[model samples]
Target: MMNDIAKMQELWQEMSSWMTTYMKSFYSPEAAKTAKSHLEIKSAKTIFFDDAQIVDGIILKEKHTWKVVKNCENLAKHLNLNEHDSLLAKMIGLFHDVGRFYQFTVYRTFNDALSENHAKLGLKVIKDLPFMAKLDEEDLATLKFAIGNHNAKEIAPTENQRHLAFAKLIRDADKIDIYRVLKPFLGPTDGTGCSPDFVDLFVAGKQCDYTKMRTQDDRKLVRLMWVYDVYFAWSLKQIVEQNYIEDIINNLVQDEKMMQGITRLRNYIQEKLQTKDIWQG
Candidate 1:
């Protein structure tokens, strides 16, 4: 257990070093200009949090736990990992959002569509970096797949032991965190209407069908349906256990037509849990 954590930390520190430098370049004045209209560059005050140490602690803990579970550690307790699995998960999670530093430095926001794909830029940084020189062939191969296609469409990995699952783990973990972060901040109590962008995404079906989800019931339904898109049932339970669905419902402004059925929403989740397979429920 300790060895896995230690190796993860080593890879994380190395990746962080590379990222800190890459961010320095990626968030420069020239870079901000390129990111215009997507993410506005905010003042340095917004670029960093009040405590650098806190950021490090949180990122390290979450990213490492995420990598382990995603690479299949949590799923199969006795599964022995070669150096490749550990290396791949460790390196990819560490670098996945280094582009975020640039987003803050340049765009002032983390919304992907409104901005750009941080994952894409992250890959560019890794490819351009010198760290590739230190990797073994297998190590590099795993890292390349994890880094390059971590955010792609959900598909089974064609390779041994399902390498792509490792990549999807980070994506699922990241989305769960997003739900946790944005749920409380949505600013509506009824869940009917949300920010215009949020509304439009649903209305257009460009996102899930939640535009008219005003009642707590509707909100719960939306969240239930969210399980369909979730990468794994483990991730689905993560949101449910965190009570993020309820938070989103309580935070949203209710659309009048959607208000009456709120209590039914919680019941629905309970109902589904009782009848559905736990792995899929």
Candidate 2:
């Protein structure tokens, strides 16, 4: 894992240098400077701090960010959003996890209860740093709202529908890719210090009732609940096509109860996908 992370960092540096040169060719010198400064801060503050904890957590997170960005692009086009909206969606995905770097660096765990609310921490980074200051007022608010609320259980009531919509996009995109991250890591392994009990709970026969989730293994239930948070049918379609749920289930110990629970969740998603009134309304 350390070797993989080192390679990823090296690739990131190469990509950053290439991008800096590319930006200078067409971007105004001032814009180029700001962009380069942003990259420098990302490297110095988040990516290259020489901490094992930060580096380890960020590899999955950084890949997740890129996946979300691509997912948002496809979602925007399918939803027929304007070019500006599409770009905004991509940007929100890119910047959503800025807080996680700080959280992991300080607390060494992704658990918000143990550390801090990563979303709020991310909001502070965006507002306090010049990294996101280049955005105009409208773009800035949308980015802030989307990133700030991406992890919330429900979208906050908003007078601005755009904020809710963009937030929904990021939430769906983020959750969709998370299945990829969880598949390999959540299971039990020998001598790796992974929790076998957690893997059992994950592969257990019933949909984990969140209220009943007291053990660390039960926490995997939250990933299952993400299906409820999904907004767009397009995102749901992608989830289905990727067979994310099936892949997850395949790794688990299945029984009648587990099958039933999985069926209920899958059916709910299918119902949501077919319910045009709910989406249009």
Candidate 3:
């Protein structure tokens, strides 16, 4: 018992340091900057405490879980990964946001700014759990690398080719499912307008020009711009085939600049998918 506790502490300290370094380098500065005021935004605790209340939190959890399952199935088929790799990918996808559960339970907010990076918190959860002990050393390392860095802007520079490949796979799979989650919230909801700070992190390049995204509606357009960060041709093909781009574009406030950006991104992916050998090119 003493040995187990000590080992857990050691692992926590090591992972904590690694997460700090990785976030310092790769965490989205724009997200933190734009949403400074919302850093303390809290989730509705009443929803969690009330027995009779219909909570979006429970619905969101179930929906997110379903999305992860779909991502695992589709990615396994698309990538044609080996059995071990396929399992690793699926497990990583399933557990990637486990931290969010704890974060909301404790802090009552999904906002990482008010709490800690859910990725790091997830690592801690995995480490503390008994199930994680069953994984082989290499599989464990890959999962850690993938879950810890899936939300990062890009893979860490220190990561090797193998780690990078797994990271990219999980990242792509996560983004693909997120489209489903964003569908209900894309446009105006009720009387309360959206907040641009909500998506400032996802805003990147000219497609979501930070300066022009002064309103929540404009920032919502950044969801369509996720294609720019897609790392796999197969993932791009899946997005195109599913018409995720069109769905996002249709819901957004169609402006000339936003449409142009989406069109250019659509063209780029279409051309990439058309290539006979995408991996080589």
Candidate 4:
């Protein structure tokens, strides 16, 4: 048993050495400046496509992944992030929903309550990938934290500013694309009004608990409440410029309280749009 354990440890060290040497040659010093051409990004894309192929009728979700990556690139550019940071941001977007493919294939549902939390599943997938070993320790941690929190109600508390910043970036990028994905599904509620608790949350400018969604109107209100959670002015601008807010509002069963929430949201959006986004990172 001791000899077998010694052999296993030796093999593991050899594999780690070979991986280190391979990655040093695979990634150039300038790789971050050309993130799209980076081998790890290519590997991530390959994993995404392979996973996507397992689930048959989710073309929309596949397309949503591409758009979310683009949104992340554009948002990074808007923030004037350096090349290394930009690459990290783009990587976060590319892998943010990596678990969704597996979730849908196995569970046949996108609902986290019905299936599993895609973000947490995504972290497991990421950690298992060999390409992730090429990333610097800090970069790898940031990537995990950002992707882990992408679908979460709120980002988990952290003092690591870089992790928090990248998390916010991925969240905004994901939400921006989500509005487009959900566009076709927006319509009048099924005559069942919004739940009283959900309405109270909306009026208070708070995000609704998605699990508590009891009606179609509750779903619509939840999306509207996402605007309050949006962290960046640039993201808010994209949402408003695309008329996503207006479209949802048009479909909602607008009681006086709903309208009050809408008014507050609109006011907040206008103010956010006028404010310049200065990157402290």
Candidate 5:
């Protein structure tokens, strides 16, 4: 496992190098500066995760970030975004979870309710980065807005279409990778069923409050309900293709109400899968 982890780290390092070179050649001088700053921050992050005292925690967090970065790039390609938009997508992905490291290191837990909102914490970290100043005012705000709202149950409203688009893109990318991160942890429930409020939300086809999760089953149900919040057909396609939805449903409690929600979700997924994913921006 350690060897596999090392290899994954090496692969990310290589990809970072390649991305830096590609951006330098393909982007304008100002954009190249932004890319360079991104590389510098990424390098620092790699070192911090590598040298952290908690080896296991750092590895998982680091791997998740890399996976989200890849998902962002793939989603951008799926949308056929222009080069500038593509770069922005990837940058937002890279920094979206920047607060997770601090949250884990000090609090020793990733639960925002118990600790801090990692998304907001990440915005503070990004705002202080000297290199971030290299980005123009508009790009910088878009980056901040996307990262800030990435973990929110719903994105905060915005009038700028470009800002909204990037926010949606990062949220989808983050959730897609999150399903993968949480997959291995799926298991038999602790015998305590989901909370009543959670069940009501599920039955209503709505998202449950993460802070209200009271049981393992509730957590599983919350993951299932995330399908309702997914923004893009392309993201839903990836989630279904990987069997995340099926796997979560299989592990969920099979009570009548749960099944009703499951039936509703399956029908929704089927309909969503058939729709074309057209990027509006």
Candidate 6:
């Protein structure tokens, strides 16, 4: 039998491989020249930050996911049985940001300021493809259910362990990557020294300049903090086992308030490690 694991890998590869090709072929050379000639704006940023941003975000999301996959594989081996569930965990990590490609290609914006949820966009990408057809309904359900809900209020109802597992993989992998990347500020970042009131309002936790309570960019930062907010022993274990807390604390820059926030989360992590982290995770 091919088994679920092989099938899951095939599905993930199918999406990733197509995504790579699409990013290249999306705007053909003639289209690029003609489009540029048509709408070239002198004031517009060269290489729209949005474009690089999503690309980098997806790239980072994938990189972080690979770390989770490695850890999950090691975890599965330690738990000592083999099947596709571990691979499923890895696949979840990979697709959690799979929508960014389309969101960028279609909207030229990842900010949601451009108006579309990446999660929703991701589902569109999954549904349009030959690869999505390959998975059985169970795997397909896990794909959307996990990816869509990765940023959702609940990863899944507690009863759906298989669905829940995929979500957890995305959460851990995404946070681990973010913390490792953003944690290292030598001093207070000072809100990049300067421009918009948006940063000021955000760090202060006041109403933002933007209409949405939180923008896509803001949500990314908020989600980073929410990593500390995760519940579940396996998730907690993954946090410590992955060293996300250390990554954040070691590079912390303090605003008195931000410092307090970091301090609190650090204590919470310590408690989870000492009192609650004994499981196989």
User: Which candidate number maximizes TM-score?
Assistant: 5
Model 6 C-alpha lDDT per residue in residues 49-98, reported as the tens digit of each score:
33544455545444554565565555445444246666665556656666
Backbone clash numbers for all candidates listed: 13, 2, 0, 0, 0, 0
- lDDT of candidate 3 vs native? 0.60
lDDT score, candidate 3, position 25: 25
Tens digits of per-residue lDDT, candidate 1, 193-239, equal: 44454344333323354544455444444543454455555555667
Winning model by lDDT: 5
Scanning candidate 6 in windows of ten residues, the lowest lDDT window is 36-45
Error of 1 at 74 (Å): 5.9
Q: For candidate 2, write residues 153-222 as lDDT tens digits.
A: 6778888878878898888888778777776755532223213443344344333334444543344445
Model 5 whole-model lDDT (C-alpha atoms): 0.77
Q: What's the TM-score of every candidate structure?
A: 0.55, 0.70, 0.68, 0.80, 0.82, 0.62
Q: Regarding TM-score, does 4 or 6 come out ahead?
A: 4
Per-residue alpha-carbon lDDT of model 3 for 98-130, expressed as tens digits? Answer: 777667656767667678888999888678665
What pairs collide in candidate 2?
Answer: 205-257, 205-258
The residue-level lDDT of candidate 5 at 151 comes to 89
Runs in model 4 deviating more than 4 A are 1-57
- Give me the displacement of residue 7 in model 4, in angstroms: 33
Pairs that collide in candidate 4 are none
Off by over 4 Å in 5: 1-53
- Comparing 3 and 4 by TM-score, which wins? 4
Candidate 3 Cα misplacement greater than 4 A, ranges: 1-48, 51-55, 188-214, 275-281
lDDT of 4 by residue, 115-165 (tens): 899998888766776657766689889989999888889999999988888
| Tens-place lDDT digits, model 5, residues 156-262 | 98888888889999999989989988998777777888999999889889997888888888889999999999999999999999999898888888889889999
Q: Note the Cα lDDT for every prediction shown.
A: 0.51, 0.63, 0.60, 0.76, 0.77, 0.54
Candidate 6: lDDT of 23?
40
lDDT of 5 at 138: 89
- Residue pairs clashing, model 6: none
RMSD, candidate 2, Å = 10.5
Model 2, position 161: C-alpha lDDT score: 77
